[model samples]
Target: MARRKKTSPLEDVLDLLAMLPWWACVMLAAVSYFLLHPLAAPIQASDIQGQGGAMVGAMMQKAVIHGLATAGQHIVPLLCLAAAALSAWRRKQRQSLLTEVAQARNTDALDGMSWREFELLVGESYRQQGYCVAEIGGDGPDGGVDLVLAKGGEKFFVQCKQWKAYKVGVTTVRELYGVMAAKGATGGFVVTSGRFTEDAKEFAQGRNIELIDGPRLFAMIQRARQTQGPSTSEHRESAITTGFPQVQAKASVTEPTANSQATTRPDCPRCGAAMEQRTARQGANAGNAFWGCSTYPKCRGTRATG
Candidate 1:
C-alpha cells in the first residue's frame, strides 16, 4: 500500500480555510463571535420580569449577532480581494522578469550578475513555468542546492554554478545525484555559464539530472520571448521597475544539425512546447550539447541528453 502524506494541524486548517469562499469566512467569523461573546459576558435575564427578561435577552443576542454579521459582510470581502490582487501583482512581476531574461541576446548580461541574482533569475524562470520555487543559500550555505522547485508535492533541486571560465565536469553531476539520493528528491539540475566535460556528460546520462550551459540558456531566453509574444511594453516595465537596461542581439544558438531532430523538438516539461537542443556554454552533461525549452523563461523546461 502507498503511504499517506501527513500534514500538520495548522496546514490542515489553512488548507480548509483556503477552500472556503470569502463570504463563508465572513459568516464563520460572525458566527464564532456570536458563540464566544456570550461566554465573555454572560447574559443576566434573571433581573427582569420573566417574559420581559426572555424578550430582552433575545433582543440582545439578535443585536449582537447582527452587528458582528454586518461588520464581517463589510470587511471580509475587501480583505480577500486585496490579498488576491497582491498575489496577482507579484506573479505578474515575476512573469515580466522571466520574459526580460529570455529575450536577452547575449550571456554577457548574465556574466555580470552575482550568484544571488543568478539564483533569483533561475527561480523566477521556473516560477513563470508554474513551479513554486524555494530559494536556499540565503541564510547560509545550502550544501549545494540554490533553489528547490515544487509542484503538486513533487520536488526538484537545482544547483547554480556561475562559472564562466571552467567546465563543469562529471564530479559535479555525481555530487548532485548523491544529494538527490540523500534527500529523496525527484530530480536535480546543474546550471553553469561555461561548459561541461565529456566525462561529466557520460556520468549524467540516465540520471535524473540536467546540465545547462550558456548558449542553451540564451536560446531558451529567446524561445521564452517568442512564446510570450515579446512586447515593447514589457521592456519598459522591467526597465522602470528594476533600472536594468535590456541587452538584445541576435546570435545563432546551438541546436541539432540533424534534420530529424530539427523537425521534432522534444515537448516542454512545463508547457508542452517543443524542446530544442541548445549547447550550453557549459553544457550540463557534455560541454557540447544540452536540451532547453524552445519557449524558455516562459516554459523554463529542459532535458539532459547523451
Candidate 2:
C-alpha cells in the first residue's frame, strides 16, 4: 500500500527520454523542433480575411494552435536535450560505479551505495553480460521490478534489494515469482546487497530465478569487468578521486584494505561459484576471517582460511 511519488510533467517527459539512448534523445530533440517550428510560424492575417465569422473562428483556432506550438517548439526540444545530457551522465556514472565496485576489496563498497545506485549497478552488470536493460524503477526504492533485462530474445525481470543489514527473505522471492508468471517473463533475478534466507533460495532453485547475494554479486561484477577488458582504469581512478558521498563516508570510518584472498578467490564446494572472505560478526567465531560461499544462506558452504 505504498504511495507512488508524484512527479511533475517535465520530470515524466525527462524520465521517458532517459529510457532511450542519448543519441535517440538528441534525434528526438531535433525532430520535435523541426516539426513544431513550422506550426509555430507566423500566420498571415490576409489568409484569414474573407468569409467573415467562419474565417475569424478558424483564425482563432489557428492562433491557439500556433501559441501552443510556439511554446512547445522551445520547451520540447529543451526537455529532450536535457534528457540527453542526463542519459549521458548516467552512463558515465554507471561505469564509474562498476569500476569502483569491481576493484573493491570487500563488500563494504556495495554497502555504501543508495538503493538507486544499486539498481544502476545491477543494470550495468547485466548490460555487460549482453542484455538490453530498461530501468523502470521510478516508483521508488521499494518498487517492484527494478530492471527489465532482455537477452537472446528472452526477457527477464530483476528486483534489487539494497538491504545492508537483514537478509532477503522468502516473501520477496515469492513476489517476484508471481510477477514473473503474470508478466510471462522467461526468468527472473532477485539481487541483493545482502544474503538471502534459506527459504528464499529453496523457492528460487527450480523456478528459473537466480538469487544473487552480496558476495556473488561482487564476483559477478569482477568477472564482468574482466570480460570487458582494460579500459576501466580511467573510470576506476575517477571513482576513487570523486568518490560517491556515501562510499566516501564509509571509507573514512574504516579504510578499505586489499584482501589477500581476493587474488585467489576460492570456489564453493557445493555450488562451484566464488567464495568470499568474510569475518564473523557474532558468536564464538566473531572477528575470525573465513572463506564463506558467495551464495551464503543459499549454499551454506564455508572453508577455513587458516
Best model per TM-score: 2
TM-scores for candidates 1 onward, in order: 0.46, 0.72
lDDT of 1 by residue, 23-109 (tens): 444555566556545544433545234466787777677667656666655454445454434434544555556566675767775
The C-alpha RMSD in Å for every predicted model, in order, reads: 13.0, 13.5
> Which 10 residues in a row give candidate 2 its minimum summed lDDT?
244-253
Which candidate number has the best lDDT?
Answer: 2
lDDT of 1 at 61: 77
Candidate 1 C-alpha error for residue 191, in Å? 1.0
Per-candidate local distance difference test: 0.59, 0.74
